[model samples]
Target: MLQTDSMWRCVCALVLTFPAYSTAVSGVLNSPTNVQLTSTNMDLVLKWDPPAGAPRDLVYTTELILRKPLMDSKPGCVNTSALQCDLTHLVVSIYGRYTGRVKAQLGAQSSAWASSDDFLLDKQTSIGPPNVSLYSNGAKLEVSITDPVFVHSSLREIYYYATYNITYWKKDRMKELKHISGLQQNRVVLHSLDPSTEYCVQVQIIASTAQKPSTPSIVHCARTPSEKEPPWVAVVVALFILAGVLTLVVFVVRHWRSLSHFLCPKYAIPEHFKESLLAPPKSSLYLVMQTSQPVEEFSDQISVVMCSRTEEDGSKKPAEEKR
Candidate 1:
């Protein structure tokens, strides 16, 4: 009876220690409670820690499982002693939120999986930079671009802005050419410029997360011409006045010479007739008078004179005093 009782006591002690052994086993597989994922060329990685408070004799195994949400009832698992596991079988599809889980394993028992954080993947190829153009129209500079026909998003919102830099006569410079969002078209016009000045303009585009600008567009140049003067200009008017004055001076000098000739004439008469013409006429039918005084006394004077002579034929001589 004593031997039997001692055996029963030993069995009871062993049964009591079983719970402690299970608790220790739980601790070994509970180390890693948090899960993280990273991606590379063609693989996704699952990262976690070792079991919690485990003794050196306790061995742990990490298991990572991935699946398409709501589609795969059973998640594919990676069984390994390493803290990180590569996801080579996971496929990337249309962009969306993905679900995954990481679990801890010890011997034949496994702990509930620690849920993983959500991840987003963009697998579409970029459409590259849109085409750009810089040109000049009369006094204005024009900037133009082609809408991105091929891009990552079909309904993607697009925005655009541009800046122009000019270097003239050896000086550094910059100008904000444009800042436009959701334009209906790609063309813009700039006006108001100093005439005869040289200018340069730069153009850029935005689509999806705004593409990198084009290699600074080639330089474009234009020079405005000076306006023309009116017809029959002021200069011609000044010349006409100068010519009219010169013609008037020539006419006056020519008329002065002619008037002087008419006022005073000089002539010499024949010597014989000169005396007869100078002699006073004989008075008969008229009277003759000569005054060596001022003409003020002649206001009431009326002068009359006659010339008479006898010819060889006894007739009143025909008076002939020729000069």
Candidate 2:
């Protein structure tokens, strides 16, 4: 019975000592190790490794402490089983200094917090692509870019400044790439392009040396206007046409008389008919008068015969002829 009593006292003492030992063990848990901070275009992520001898089912919680010019904010991740936490939805300042820390928890016990080195938000975050606009100049293409405006409440700057990497190519000839880099201005002019040709352009944002460039903007397509004909060319063509028309008019005027005669001739008697009808009658009369009688007797006979013929035809002779 005495041995049993001693065993009971010893058991109670051991039980009391066990609680203190457990408490001490829980307090000495090693902190998480190798904490890291990384970022995407829109969000920040915190990652850490569990300490040695950490339980397989150990859960992690994280917190972000931000220090800005005039403000301080604390955003936390609670009761998460993941080794990494995404603090994207937090309303932390974009232009602020940030530090992320993580702690591992197993049931009621928790490890010490592992903190990351101080980092600037903009230094770790990438800028988004800029908006692009295209215009059709006569023989050139005009490209205008609008830089991204950060809308975080903590960001007081009006605009985010960035350099641009502009890439353009002809739609039909995509193998040939044209690039313009380190351009600080928002607008650029592309020259020596074929008139009325299809072209495509894209732009990317380069914010700082630490941050990588953002994704390229959506491709913009535009066609340059067609070329205009020169005034001198039109004038020369008009002069040639006018000269040709005038030459044709002068040729027609010079040949008009010959053309008319060929088309229509006047009606008249032939020279051969006049000679055959009049010459024979005159020759026969002359021969008859010479062979028949003397000139005076022939003339008197011709007059008496003409008078007899005139009376027989019911015509009267003049008084001078009768005498």
Candidate 3:
């Protein structure tokens, strides 16, 4: 067992380091390793790892094998230095089986052809989600889908005909989702939607006669426009606003004096009115007026009487005695 293992390791090393020289015993160089043929939406690609000891500058040639007709990797993939080749045009039908063979060549020497495993397009091909765009029209939403771009071939060349499965729902009512299937048109309109509502939609492509459908597109959301307003409603609102502003301007020009009186009054506050808001009540004041009492009257106590005569001693005698 150890001897077998050592021999295998030596063979691997030789293949990795060997140039494109055919061996004397086999008359052929080592073949490529890990050859694989893959399909992306029916776009065929052939890839492989170089021989273990293969040198650089060794060109490769690839061939496509079908049931009856054999095809060469086109677009000058022959003698190509690239490790991969595009054989998309060689795929005639999705239901057909395909295989790829590649050989390394350097001048007069060549390697044994390395063949890939059988490839079934319908079973092995990978499909991608469609591109989605949304347009809003009041109470309706319009969806537009674009097919995913393939590496070599177009979507129509493979599928011939395709349909879409659209799923949508109101953002608020997520549990109540709706689906529309088998829609043939690339552009579709969803009507009867609630006005001014946000709705989300996702779409998936179903290739005709294909067993698998493309992945669902990313979620897209758009809000519908509000319900249509009467054409004259805006005009009426504008006229009313204009009239109110004009009326205000006219009133300001006419009664500006009255407004100024309140805005900048000329009258001073009376002493009573100047009292503090925090002052005590009238009964708590130093002097309180009684509404029921009559006002008191006062007179001069001294009377001035004309002197009838003067006393000889120059003293003003009593006017009554003189009289």
Candidate 4:
């Protein structure tokens, strides 16, 4: 009975080891599915779905293949556990066509690469929103655009060939849409705008004919400056008026007595009194008288009187005489 138990145990061990050995020799990893290529402003990205029933520890490898206008470059990613790869570091021409592939890999076994649909770099790639800056220059608005920089060296060349699409309008009037396209320069001047008016501006990137335009940038606003009055001009006018008022006040204070006397004098003569003093006398008269005292004591006392009158004809006559 002990010998029978030992044989049974050996058979159980073989059965267990056989299955593990066969799995290592015969098992092949499955290919990744749904491989796709997409682009952002900064880089091109390759993505794939893991194979169904793949092991929890399965890793992936990715490679980029140039299809048109062929070149000798093959850029690849290796031993990555993630589902996505960034191929922006590869320096391929913007006009060239590209395709990508990915595969599932175990320790010693790897599946066939699942290829992605072909795409052109310029046609499929996208660029980030441009940096917008605005300034008010009198009645005009100055707009400036700046392109975004990528982490990959190969993607920087897109900025050189990129053109811009700009749109601007008054803030209150949304129906009036003004668009400017194919602008190579970073700065543009908007003219014939009302002073102190609010305006909104937006910008997008158009890399080439093959590429779609980038998403529009955030709206930015700026106001044109209002006209200003000169400070010196107002000050000068006020000073002139003040000087005139002060001069008038000084003249009145100094000559107040003279002005009053000229209006009403202190001494004056009446006309009727002056006429009486100038008229001549109409007549004149004269008179004389005499008296005796010592002779009248021995005899009788005697008294005598005389008078004369002058007329307007200058004749004089004695009216009465006594002896």
Candidate 5:
């Protein structure tokens, strides 16, 4: 009877070691994995390994609990079958230390919580490289840089870092190269550079804390135009153009008067002379005769008469001989 009891106990132990439904439920709540916070929008991302030990009849579900200064309040939670969650909408203040955790749930049972090593939530990353823009101001190459927005209000100032390659070359020969570095405001003013040389330039940025310098910007090149003028050259050019326009306007006004006289004859004539000129009578004729001859010899010759009569009256008048 004792031997039979021992055999039954052995059978029970074997049954507990490997349940029929246990194969479907298997996971472990590993340590908190990826932990990072974005500076701009205060977005938080947390990840972890899959959890272990779920009830044989239930599927394992993962939950994320994020809290500032450890698990103080009911941690903002999310339930998913995946291993990670983004906690972007958490309204935690950016003042104190922050900690996050993950837990696995299966039916009424939950695995151990895995928490992240505490880190300050209010930390701000260093600024990025300033956006460099290139331009020119008469015979000089100019650079303009715009600063990045600061996440931490403590950042008060930004400094520019720059380098350049300037060269003068001929057929199969090159000479006069230079590299320069300095700290200044957002604008770099280069003076007395070689006028006819080709130059390539790059710019970088550094913050007040003196972090690792940002990656240098792409190289830009400009050959200084020949040194022929000063800043006042633009004003001189404008004045010259204005003088030329004024002279042309005066010439145009004088020429326009002559053109008007030639095109319109009525108003173009002198008013005093026009009043003395008589209007001609319509359909009339005038005649004049001057001669030195014997009066009797020309007595029978027909003569033209100056008449101011209508055509009907002239046609009815008969011819009469002079005595």
Candidate 6:
């Protein structure tokens, strides 16, 4: 019975060992999928999606393949946990064609490398958009555009020359657009614009090495300044006003007495008129006596007569008479 128990235990051990060995020999990992290469402002990047059923702890490795005679892949992003890698520094030739590849790794097991589509460095790389600033000069508008930022190379270093494309229009008149293409100046002046009017503008770069023109900058708006009067005109007007004030002051100094006399008088009243107004009123006795009837006058002279007694009939009787 003890011999039979030992054989059964050996059989159970064999079964467990066989399954583990089979998994080790036959199991295969899935490679990374959907690899892509892209660049913006000369900054190249490699991106990929994790393999199906990939573990959360799986690491990744990346390589850059340059298409040429006897060329080999350059290894980077080795044993990395991130899904993306920056290969901006690995680009040796600005005009060369390139490709990117990546693989998923977990301990001793690793998937095959998945490749990306071919990328042309000179024609496929993207450039940054332009930046715009506006200023309102008197009777004109000034637009200023700046060069796009570069990652590993400058505009002059790659293309040797660059230009700008400007589009402008009156405010609220978007359909009537005006374009100024292939401008070489950063500070562009728009002349012959309407005065005291608002205008909107956008700018783009014409890079020779870029696949197309750089993205257009944000729209900027400003109003043209109004026309101003000349400085000499104001001076002339002020001089005229000062001259008139001086003339008026001189005239007043010369005719001050005449003006005062016309405005006020100093005549005096007679003394008789004052007495007549202030005297007390008299009675009307003289006026009534003078208004009586006139009496008759005698022509011959008469002698005086002395009498001691008068007649009784109201008649005078003379006692002695003298002629």
Best by lDDT: 6
TM-score of each: 0.30, 0.49, 0.50, 0.55, 0.44, 0.63
Q: List the residue pairs that clash in candidate 2.
A: none
Give candidate 1's TM-score: 0.30
Model 2 lDDT at residue 221: 93
Model 3 poorest 10 in a row by lDDT: 67-76
The 10 consecutive residues of candidate 5 with the worst lDDT sum are: 164-173
* Superposition error at 8 for model 2 (Å): 36
* Residue 41 in model 3: lDDT: 61
Better of 1 and 4 by TM-score: 4
- Residue 58, model 4: Cα distance from true site in angstroms: 2.1
Candidate 6 C-alpha lDDT tens digits along 218-320? 9999998777778999999999999999999999889999987888866788999999989855548766667777788767756787756555766666765
* lDDT comparing candidate 5 with the true structure: 0.53
Per-residue C-alpha lDDT of model 3 across residues 207-316, encoded as one tens digit per residue:
87566888789999999999889889999999999999999999999999999998998987777777765576677343445444677998756655556556576766
* Global Cα lDDT for candidate 3: 0.82
Off by over 4 Å in 5: 1-28, 31-77, 80-95, 104-111, 121-126, 150-184, 191-202, 209-323
Candidate 4, residue 134: how far the Cα is off, in Å? 0.6
- Look at candidate 5 and give me any clashing residue pairs: 27-51, 27-52, 28-51, 28-52, 29-51, 29-52
Local accuracy by lDDT, each model:
0.51, 0.77, 0.82, 0.79, 0.53, 0.85
Winner by lDDT between candidate 2 and candidate 1: 2
Query: Could you tell me which residue pairs clash in candidate 3?
Result: 15-52, 15-53, 16-52, 16-53, 17-53
Q: Considering TM-score, where higher is better, how would the candidates rank from best to worst? A: 6, 4, 3, 2, 5, 1
- Regions more than 4 Å wrong, model 3: 1-29, 68-76, 89-96, 106-109, 120-131, 146-161, 169-178, 191-200, 215-220, 226-323
After aligning candidate 3 to the native by TM-score, how far in Å is the CA of 230 from where it should be? 10
Determine the C-alpha RMSD for candidate 3 after optimal superposition of all C-alphas.
25.8
